[model samples]
Target: MDHHSSHFTQAFIHLDRLTHNMRLLQGLVGIRPLWPAIKANAYGHGAQIVGRHLVGLGYKTFCVAHVSEAIDLADAGLKATFIVLSATLPENSPYLVAYPCEPVVCTVEMVESLAGEAARTGKTISAHLKIDTGMGRVGIHPDAVADFLERCRNYPNVSIKGMMSHFPMADEADKSFSQQQIAQFHRTREVARSYGIRTFHFANSAAIFDLPDAHSDAVRPGISVYGLKPSHVMSNPQVDALQPVLEWKTRITFLKEVPAGTGLSYGHAFRTDRPSLIATIPLGYGDGMSRLLSNKLELLIGGVRCPQVGRICMDQCLVDVTALRGRVKLGDSVVIVGRQGREEITVDDLAQQLGTINYEIVTNIAGRVPRIPVGPSMAGASTESVGDDGTLKTLTER
Candidate 1:
């Protein structure tokens, strides 16, 4: 029954926070459909789990960055309308069409290929046309929007379900560039409507929280669904109340007393400043704990902050627990990226110390760390039964 004995670190996902965040997003973009972006394994919180939880919360649509991700969701029996936010090759078009997922058409060649395929199969292929409104990525040029729509308009099997664009500066507090992107999107949508094309969207997570006017018909919320703020620039009075859903944790495997001046971990980057009670945790860079966090990060042990005292190894790291006010022992719980009582350690906090972004912080966590989905079923209990092969099992089944 001791989950930590399995030698796997765990990322606990708070499903209630996920649902709450979606509701908050709905409140922000009233009546506009919210597509929870679950790309990159739902930002490393486990995609299938997050997707299923969101779908249960009445989310009708979900978005990912590639076709494979959509396939994964489909294989998991997700019945929501899934949208692939990136374009697919002509060869891959058939598979995309075959699967119950929609592709975001970004180029004329892709549009032509998909249209041709849909016509041949005698099935309506739903797609969203992506317009390049200054993101300078995969999207049709603004000037070519009309011609592109024209080519697909007569195609019998291709249905332009929606039109969308990415904002280059929507994360900024300064709304000038974001507003311009929105304006350009509106202009492009108007051009499409001149040809009688409606159902357009341009806002993403940033716009969903910061710019209400940018929410055209729907908003694709990526980061906010995980309960993190959109970006640092948008991290102001508006998003101060959002709760982070993902919690990175592990158990102390062993405790040892080290003499002062003892060299620790790789390259001797750290030496004990005094006689230290070091706790060795079975988590390291291989478990998605960043190598850059060595000696710079702190973990919450028994609700007390303990500094990482050595170079973060590939499979283990040492935390100095000498200053702890209470007795620390082996098998005690440790928190690397979540709240411990009134104290909290966040991906943003780690990113700030590591000089990276929150996205990289969570995504880089190695797959070895098993994500344990927590909800009302767990009743805030940290203990859960995981399989012998490191898969998490339901406690009731155990």
Candidate 2:
């Protein structure tokens, strides 16, 4: 918990880069409010750090995957409007009413429960109506939007503040399906607006980059806000301007010279063909470094790419630092997904190697790893820890 003490691995969150990404996205959306998606711990960039910084930057609203995620941030003193993005049962009405959250509504039972709770508690609950244009997810059908709105109107204490939909394939190279979804949402938006819905949002991170027309009333930019491309097929060249906000780093803990024919780590997955200098960093699958990366992953040390030889263990892994030989030493910096001198390793690089998306590469990072805030704005900011429950604790004061 000591800020000055050595850490096995630390995720350096660049607050300045987050601001840059927001500005670039703001340019794309004009004056429309960007309700950043801070769910899954801001795509594992540390939501408390990201949420607190964004609150300081004047962002009033955020989108989260569940009511509990919003409650976690609210409990951490983040004062913002959290639009709960998932459909939930009526059982969670009390927590939803207690917190400053707008639950996305797709069923009448949920709305009735919210209305009952709001009336009983002497409060008015604001919610968003979800129409399943084509996502085929948990939303009312487009044809049922009018009747749903009418039924919701019966509950005067429950206000339908917005109408929303999602895009299933907006990131694809061919966006014919996305365009059709947009048209379908547009029709429902028109009908919902007539019923006094103030906001009609239909854009996700992919739609923000490729579908300008889908940027209805407000845009929910998720992965882009954290500087990860929604997908490789985005048609806009402007998305390239976004900067990544997280850098995963660790330190060299031990070093040894292994002769030819020497095996490394568990199961002897990698065997040395020649004398090799092997360095062990206190990182492995326990820290979200996938075992699948065993013999294929490369880490950066001394500005050079070093292959991670052998099976990655649960608590440690071996990096062949043969190139650095005498140059590398104990406590030397190692880059997991960051820049070391001129060489850079990004989440996209890891995703490509693992045959997964960038989102998984970050969110998979275990909560045990400390996320240290670092940037021009974070000069005096404190280091924080994300607990297993997803609550963030400040380790030190500014």
Highest TM-score scorer? 2
lDDT of 2 by residue, 1-398 (tens): 55432456878888899989999999899999999999988888888888888888889899999999999889978889999999899999999999999999999999999999999999998999888888887898999999999888789999999999999899889999999989888887888888998898989999988999999989999999989999988899988888999999999999999899998888887899999999999898998999999999989999999999999998899999999988999999899998988999999999999999999999999887878787655323445655555566566644
User: How do all models score by TM-score?
Assistant: 0.92, 0.96
Candidate 1 lDDT, 145-209, residue by residue in tens? 88888878776577787888988788877889888888888878888887666788888888887
Best by lDDT: 2
Model-by-model lDDT, in order? 0.80, 0.89
**What's model 2's overall lDDT?**
0.89
Candidate 2: the clashing residue pairs are none
What TM-score does model 1 achieve against the real structure? 0.92
Backbone clashes in candidate 2 total: 0
- Which regions in candidate 1 have their CA more than 4 angstroms from the true location? 1-5, 377-398
